[model samples]
Target: MVLVTGGTGFLGSTLIKILVDQGTAVRAIKREHAVIPDALVSSSLVQWVDADITDYFALSAIFTDVTQVYHCAAKISYQPADHAAMLHVNIEGTKHMVNLCLEHAARLVHVSSIASLGVSKNGELITEDSKWDDGADNSKYAVSKYESEMEVWRAIMEGLDAVIVNPSVIMGVGSGSKGSGVIFNMVQKGLQIYPPGTVGIVDVEDVAQLMVMLMNKPEISGERYILNSENMSNKELLDRISKLLGKPSPTIEAKPFMLGIAWRAAKLVSLIKRERPSLTREAALAAASKLAYSNKKIVDATGYLFKPVDRTLEETSRLF
Candidate 1:
């Protein structure tokens, strides 16, 4: 039996659908009162359990008879106010999940983010061997994910079989203007300013497929793979989305100083409205930083090809 955490999330729900379609008996854990996605609501093969990963006793009860585990649950936030929750859910929760996997002797497939990986020192493509610099200008979310990954490594040292995948920005349809879909929605609404930075991107399907491939290959254990289809500037990505959505492309470039003002204004607006800010200081910095990731290791290991980013945007545009 296979168990999946964060089953209601975008990537987790997609992964569960694939697993169930493959005739796998899957059990998924979700937070109490979490709404199940429509895509996963009709799956008879999935047994849903409401449990929080941070609660060890409650989470451990659902691990019975589980042979494989996919750790897909994570909290993502760039706001300073969300630091505590992000650390609790991403780091402490992962520690508990790692401990449960160790006790159950279950093979683990951990879904990490490229945020945990290091920035390229020489402006080259970032690979698995890139050293994470804790002192560098890193986001709180990155710090949380990095520490969470350390927990998985600790478990590995104690004889738990596992593999990790660090995926770039995952994009897909049906996200309803949340997560990565926010970018698509911004373009559709004629966002005029584009950040002058580049980033790696991948399809959500590619990430899910790669996770399943890594889980089935025991010989590939004890290593982390970087999954990225292509690296492109934010302007290029937004331009593509605009064209696909039949909207005007972003012509104004948002420089660092401009972004600083924008983020501050957004924060003030959020405070008044009692809503999360769409732009945070950390997110603004990330948008202005150029980063690229290499998928050579995963490609060579599995000989798997990724869907082109433009094509993914084209397909996802229909959903808007």
Candidate 2:
């Protein structure tokens, strides 16, 4: 049986649907108040378990008879106010899961983000071997993910069979206004400002498929693969979404000065509404930076080709 954490999330839910369809017995762990996605609601092959990853006793019990474990639960935030929660969930929670997996001796597949990977300083492509520089201007989200991956690496040293996949921005349908889907929604609403940063993007299905493939290949243990399909500027990506959605493409380029003002205004609005700011200072900086990742490692390792991100965007636009 396969145990998947964060099974109610965008990627995790999609993965459970695929596994159940393939007649794989899956034990999915979700928060008690988390609503099950419509796609997995009727699947009898999925055994739902309600428990937080931080609860070692609860999680340890669920690991019984599990052959493979997929650690997908994570906290994503760029707000400074959320850093504590991010560390608790993304770092400490992962440590608990790592310990449990070690005790059960189950093969583990950790779903990490490209945020954990280091940036290229010499204008070169970032690959699996890039060293994460802690002194760099990394976001709290990136720091949390990097620390979580450290737990996975620590487990590997202690005799855990595990592999990690660092996926770029995941794009697909069914995520609604969450995750990378918010980018599509913003474009459809006639967002006029475009960030100049270049980002690596991959389809949600491709990420899930690669995780399953890696889990089946024990020979690939103790290695992490970057799962990006293509690298494109934010303007190009938004324009493609705009065309597919029949919306006007962004006309204004967001310079650093403009983004600085925008984030401050967003912070004031968030304070008034007592809600999280739509644009944090860290997120604003990331939007204006150019970063690209390489998928050569994963492509060469598994011989699996990723679907073109532009096609994925076009297909996802139809669903909206």
Candidate 3:
């Protein structure tokens, strides 16, 4: 049996449907209050269970007869106020998952993020071998993901058969104005300012397919793959989305100082509204960073060809 955490999430739901179509029986966990996506409501092969990843007892009860696990549950927040909660859910929750996977001797496919990967000093492409410095000025989200991955590595050292995937800005349909999907919405609204950064993007289907492929391969244990299809500046990416969505492309570039003001203003607004800031200092900085990731390792390892960025955008825009 296959067990999937975060089955209600964007990537997790996509992965579950793929497994169900392949005639695999899947046991997917969700938080008690989490709403099931419309796509999974009719999937007969999936057994939905109410469970919290941070609670070991809740997870332990559901691990019976589970032979394969996909650890997709994670907390992704860029605001400073959410740091503690993010740490608890991302780090401690992963600790619990790792322990349970170890106890059950199940093969694991951990869905990490490119945020956990380190940036190159000389602007070279970041691969799996790039060294991560905990002391460096990192975002709250990056630190949490890196620590979570540490738990996976610790489990690996103790003889757990596991593989990790670091996916960059996952783009696809059904995200509904959240995460990278927000970009599509912004483009539709005639967004004018573009972030001065370059990002790696991948189709959601590609990431899910690769995870299943890696899970089936016993020879690929203890390896990490960066699942990025292409690298392009935020401006170009936005332009492509705009073209496909039949919206006006962003023409103005948002400079660093402008972003500084924007985040500060958003913080002030958040304090007044008692809500999380839409724009954060760390997020603003990340929007200005220029980083490149390499998919050579995964490509060579599996001889897998990824979907083109244009094709992914086109399909997702059609859905939008």
RMSD (CA, Å), each prediction: 1.2, 1.0, 1.1
Residues 233-317 of candidate 1 have per-residue lDDT tens digits of 9999998889888999999999999999999999999999999997899999899988999999999999998998888898899
Q: Which scores better on lDDT, 1 or 3?
A: 3
Candidate 1 residue 134 C-alpha distance from true site, Å: 1.2
TM-score of each: 0.97, 0.98, 0.98
lDDT against the true structure, each candidate: 0.91, 0.91, 0.93
Model 2 Cα lDDT, one tens digit per residue, 240-310 = 99989999999999999999999999999999999999899999988987889988889898999899987
Clashing pairs in 3: none
* Model 1 clashes, total count: 0
Which runs in model 2 stand beyond 4 Å of their true positions?
Answer: none
In candidate 2, position 248 carries an lDDT of 92
